[model samples]
Target: MEARLPYDDYPVVFLPPYESPPAWVPPHERLYHPDYNNELTQFLPRTVVLKKPPGAQLGFNIRGGKASQLGIFISKVIPDSDAHRAGLQEGDQVLSVNDVDFQDIEHSKAVEILKTAREITMRVRYFPYNYQRQKERTVH
Candidate 1:
């Protein structure tokens, strides 16, 4: 038998015994708390600015952003290219391009956005696991 909390219907937010979430904390929002996950720092989001001269390529290929794969992701980072130099890596999820959210964007639309942006400020995070767990959470 499982032990019941004082409020069984409400979920509990459990952090490490030594650490506590600052101020008021909600169970669903614990993920946004910096100290909530030990792996947060390891998968920190980083910003990359890319400028491509006319008739030049940005040096990266993107994949995903379909029903099967819901987020735009970096599939390749060509060596010696600007993307590689900026530390872009394969499997990096493109959170946004020019500040436009790309997480649930369409494949063709994402391509068009990137191609049209002469200089793009991309916010991405490297999630080695591809963040399937988070996707599953959002589905419900």
Candidate 2:
């Protein structure tokens, strides 16, 4: 039989079989916080929506939807664009798109609905905050 060293007298050491500490982790596609993408402020839409599909990788969730309201809003309607021609105004709070309430839907699901909708009828609360309409603001 092999002899065993005394617990107190043995030399304290980490075995070589163990892996070394990680220096850096490889970057991967991942959700930053709150929602899946990085900046919510950048992606924040006046309209919110929910959607589901069997082939979809992510489960049902909410995402930025088509603009419901139009000016000095969190979501801006591009000038002379489809959204702009649709009578959508800035600072409009989107209650729903295609009559679907999107208060708490997930991001992935929202994308699906927006993509699939043929004729979207968005219900909006316009200019509740009294923000002035302006040209598109640029992020510096």
Candidate 3:
């Protein structure tokens, strides 16, 4: 008697081997692709300018820390909001807002500065996944 394997009667289809995508492709576009490795080493820090009309929410949260610590980090970005549309992401360390350095500023003062501005320009650095992982390992 011959042994029967499951789905043996079905026709076989083979696919080509996967190749890594070019580094220039935006991170959002690479998501879900089989060859995407989530490496953003080549990504450079950029400034994002967002102009919010009166009564428009900034759509993000900020956490204030000591003056000696690093700049305030973007804790959260609400989806489909002004911040999200402006490409704001969690873990972005903010360097400045509208040409003002808030690195050592008080949290409330920073919040006030952002609150009064209709046009906000933020310089942020996005820490890559590998870098963040390494930071965590060293912290512990």
Candidate 4:
């Protein structure tokens, strides 16, 4: 009687272990699928300057303290509106308007600042939805 083994006639080859690129490699230089490179998390907060003609709506809502506690926040952005076209997003914390600090400001006062300006320069911090939800869930 002879002992039998599976695939006794097949040739086998071994390959060296694969190594990933070093962390120091720049993202653009790394070998990655083109479709995988669009990372939304890498986006940084940016200031946007919008020039609205008189009577033109900014197309966003400003809320104070209710959801953001001390910070004035962009509550809503109307689709296809000037604010939307200008890159304003919901949940962004308004840092300043023109040159004035908006921290802890009243909602009406913030609106006043916006309404009085023909050209608005807004500095905002982008608040990701997940981060905001996590913040709201935390008890403090």
Candidate 5:
């Protein structure tokens, strides 16, 4: 037999212990408080940025075929790191490092590029799957 459980509609927002949302208000409509926003930093997972000098090389890894099952593969950048400062985001596909094509290079060679280059020029493909849905329109 299929069992049913009760569902309580709770607000996703952070609330103080002494404060409670109004009964008539739905959780989704709650406003974000600046203090609550600051507190959220403590709960969510975060990445560390690797530090780099004025001009430093960047790197990434890719597995599977050139198409499917491809992930960022490697995360060498740290939070607040130099690469992050240069506008490098996580999950970015590293197409080229130092203007060198990475289509068929060995893994070790990729690492060497990051270690030696004074400045990194990576041609990255940001989001492959989700962005492909740009042409579709949906109802909220």
Candidate 6:
């Protein structure tokens, strides 16, 4: 029987049978911390830099901000888009965009920052399992 660790929608095997860790993981893709007590439990912040082609969209949806008090989160990502190719994912918290701090920015302001930039460098962190709980904690 395959022992599996549960996730909200993505169950994974505890480990691959007798396989050693990868010889290397890309810096942006490394799992730097695994402690439950860490505010970010399972993922590391990835800096993704994307430059939108002329007249083309960045192709991602965002949610949350200071007004909403939910924090900035990536609500959707379009497949094959630059954002997707850069490794942005749904539920990723946008810590910064174009190096502008997003943690306390208003919704309208956040929208403006994303819309105005031709090139964006963002630090994003994804925490799928405890997303709602984390948001709640941040709110309180």
TM per candidate comes to 0.63, 0.37, 0.60, 0.59, 0.41, 0.62
Candidate 6 error regions (>4 Å): 1-42, 129-140
lDDT-based ranking = 1, 6, 4, 3, 5, 2
Candidate 5, residues 91-112, lDDT tens digits: the string is 4455666567655455566667
Candidate whose lDDT is highest: 1
RMSD (CA, Å), candidate 6 to true, equals: 13.5
Name the regions of candidate 4 deviating beyond 4 angstroms. Answer: 1-43, 66-68, 129-140
Candidate 5 residues lying further than 4 Å off, grouped into runs, are 1-76, 128-140
Off by over 4 Å in 2: 1-74, 127-140
Q: Per-model C-alpha lDDT, please? A: 0.79, 0.45, 0.73, 0.74, 0.46, 0.76
Residues 63-124 of candidate 1 have per-residue lDDT tens digits of 77755455877877899999999999987889999989998887789999888888989999
- Candidate 1 residue pairs in backbone clash: none
Q: Candidate 3 residues 1-140, lDDT tens each?
A: 99877797878998756878565756777777666766674356778898879887889987643442555667779999889988888877677999988677777788888888999999887754433433333321
Residue 136 miss distance in model 3 (angstroms)? 11
Greater-TM-score candidate between 3 and 6: 6
Backbone steric clashes in candidate 5, count: 7
Identify the superior model by lDDT, candidate 4 or candidate 5.
Answer: 4
lDDT of 4 at 33: 46
What are the RMSDs of all candidates, in order?
A: 11.4, 19.0, 15.0, 15.6, 14.5, 13.5
What tens digits encode model 4's per-residue C-alpha lDDT throughout 3-66? 6667967678877567785346466755674444556653465798988899888888866643
lDDT, candidate 2, residue 38? 47
- Residue 92, candidate 5: Cα error in Å is 0.7
State in Å the error of residue 124, model 4.
0.6
Deviation in angstroms for 26 in model 2? 64
Q: Residue 44 lDDT in model 2? A: 40
Q: What local lDDT does model 4 show for residue 138?
A: 34
- For TM-score, the strongest prediction is 1
